[model samples]
Target: MTLDPEDSKLITLARAARARNEAAEGAAVRDETGRTYSATNIALESLTLSAVQVAAAMAVSSGARSLEAAALVTAGEGPSAADTAVTGELGAGALHVAGPDGVLRS
Candidate 1:
């Protein structure tokens, strides 16, 4: 499937985050203002957060009231229910799924 340039950019950012951090998953979100935030999954002893959760938190902390879209890069089947829930709470209309290789799945 064809993706918009902006959506493609999100995939690129997410893929890079996963590779750079060597994390299980990476996620990126575009805010209503066109700002983008990206993060990798956090699995520390004291804290565990999905990539999408981290990305959404970053956007919220940075004054993003709502999200336009979100992207998740993972080798797993797809984003988990919790991942999609976070994006939904932030008002994201779409959640793009991609593999670690940066191929868009949905």
Candidate 2:
């Protein structure tokens, strides 16, 4: 698929997060203000969070009121229901899914 430059940037950011952390999943979100946030999945003994959730939280904590788009880079099929719910609450318009190879899947 031909993605907008901004969307492509999100995928690049997500891929970098995954590579840097050696994590199973990474996610990036673009807020309404055009700010982007990226994060890797958190999987500690006492806490677990999907990459998408972490990215969304980062956007929110950084004072983003709404989301314009989100991207996930994972070997898995797609983002979880919880991930969608969080982004939906933040008014995300699109959720882009990409493989570990950085190829857009959906």
Report lDDT (CA) for all predictions.
0.95, 0.96
In model 2, the runs with Cα more than 4 Å from the true position are none
Instruction: Give the C-alpha lDDT of model 1.
Output: 0.95
Q: Candidate 1 lDDT, tens digit per residue, 1-106?
A: 9989998999999999999999999999999999999999999999999999999999999999999999999999999899989999889989999999898899
State the TM-score for model 2. Answer: 0.98
Candidate 2, 1-106: lDDT as tens digits: 8999999999999999999999999999999999999999999999999999999999999999999999999998899999999988999888999999999999
- lDDT at position 49, candidate 1: 94
